[model samples]
Target: MKKNIVVTGGTGRFGNHLKSISTKHKLFFPTKNQFNILNFNSMLKYFNKTKPDIVIHLAGFSRPMELHEKDINKSINLNIIGTANVTMACSQKNIKLIYFSTNYVYPGINGNYNEDDPLKPFNNYAWSKLGGECSVKLYKNSLILRVCMTEKPFIHKKAFANVKTSFMYHDEVAKILFKLLNKQGIINIGGKAQYIYNFAKKENKKVKKIYQNKNMKIKVPFDSTINIKKLQKIVKVKF
Candidate 1:
């Protein structure tokens, strides 16, 4: 019998891709309205009924990075508190949990940060994700993916030419996820580190090049590329 896998943010950009590739495992993606992460009882009830072997917790606030800065409460409630609720519910039921994290958790000024490197988040989004990471660590049966994924074809008209990162398409990340579903602990999931504009130009030649200044309103990570050598050896391919 196929094991059941439940994705918390089934309607999210990344979750949608996870749902598409879930063949070996039966996938269950519940919408935010139906499965509110803020409500612990709601998640507990569902966990009791489905009893999923693995829960990919994807529901969280992201994008428009300014939103996290302006609304501290929302960021705390969704990414931090919501993750706590999920962690508590999963811990009680003894279910495996996979937490989606970001490379921004590391200092963006440097490159090639390993999974064990110290974290110095440059923005609120990273802080919120780190908040979630703290909870996942408390639970022994959990995995945290410090993902460096971007939308395919680059969504920006002007990309930062000077900035470096390990960016992967959402589809690519989704394809690689299942191969490591059973693995526990933290893993850096991304492609080789390179200029952001160069990575985007491959799929979008017309994308303009621009530089971001530190004085800007939004705090951006300059070079948050992660070291995925361990992951490469496990997957046996460049991602």
Candidate 2:
């Protein structure tokens, strides 16, 4: 059955792909001016107008992981507080909420993390995302997807050979998202777990190899791969 779906941050990288794939539902991608997550009144006002059945909460701070450190306040306000506002608005209307979180919430030391696994955010960026997760967890009618996805064409020239992760392209994940809308709680969403170099080389053979070393300013996870067995059971697609 078709339903009304509102996507926050619909203009963003992942949102842009999601908008392209979501044809079955009455989707609304509200701009910041139209539906600001930071302002509950704005969110509520938009929700009241759209009367959506579900809200895909994707509005948050991401990228250039260092930004989280440089501006902790911005990170907290946008990612944590902004998500909290969204969650509250969704809860008030009893709308199903789907949150896009990151796989970095899990301890990178061990790969193959499941929904039940203990969380240990690798960096401040991950911590802020996890903070958002706290509010979503409180809402019963919600789904949290700890996704590990990247843009197509592999933006980085040098890929880490040792660091392992379940990196799926944004377009790939977007194709499978609608199938998991009814899912509740947390689910690990990504492609086959492999070395960053291998994942990159598949798309760009010319991609150079690099290593994660102590000299690096950012804390790179050695192994942040997620187990998608639960996800496989939900969707027909194999990833």
Candidate 3:
């Protein structure tokens, strides 16, 4: 059956990819004005009108990592309060909520974190997403995806040599997402564990590798790769 699906953040990098991959489902990609997630009343009205069976929540504070650190209020409002409003509306309407979280939520020191690992955010951005997870956990019909996805073909000319992460491209993650739409609860979505340079080299052999020193000022995780055995068992994919 082609169930109705609403994808928030339709214009975002990942959300846009979901639109292309979710052609089999009855998809509605609404702009913020059409369904302002920040406004509880607006969210309620939209849910009542659309009456979708599933809501893919990709809308949240991302990019310019500095934003989360500088404007803590906005990060809390968008990721936490916004998520609470959406989950509340979905619960009332009996709609399934699929949240897009980050792998940074896990303490980066531990390389392979499972679904049961305690959350220790590496930065304010991760903390905000974890805040959203808190609200979704309150709703029984919610699925939280702790994703470590990135752009394909090494979007950048230079890659970090020392940073290790489970980086899958936006398109690759999009396909897996469609396959696991029906499943619920927490799922860590990503690719194999490897250094940033090695992961990028797969797509672009010519990609330059620049090593980041331990004393570097950048506040990034050392090794935040997740254990994807459960994801593989469920989705039956090698990703």
Q: Is candidate 1 or candidate 2 better by TM-score?
A: 2
TM-score of each: 0.95, 0.97, 0.96
Candidate 3 regions exceeding 4 Å error are: none
Best by TM-score: 2
Give the TM-score ranking, best first.
Answer: 2, 3, 1
* Residues 105-146 of candidate 2: C-alpha lDDT, one tens digit per residue: 999888999999999999999999999999999999999999
Assess each prediction's global lDDT (C-alpha) against the native: 0.88, 0.92, 0.88
lDDT of 3 by residue, 1-239 (tens): 67788888888888878777746788888899988888878777777778899999999888889889999998998899999989998999999999999999999986899999988999999999999999999999989999999977678898888888999899988888877778889999998998999999988999998887787676678899999988999776563
Question: In model 1, how large is the Cα lDDT of residue 151?
Answer: 90
Stretches of candidate 1 off by over 4 Å are 214-218
For candidate 1, the 10 contiguous residues with the lowest summed lDDT are 213-222
Q: Return the TM-score for candidate 2, rounded to 2 decimals.
A: 0.97
Give the residue spans of candidate 2 off by over 4 A: 214-218
Clashing pairs in 3: none
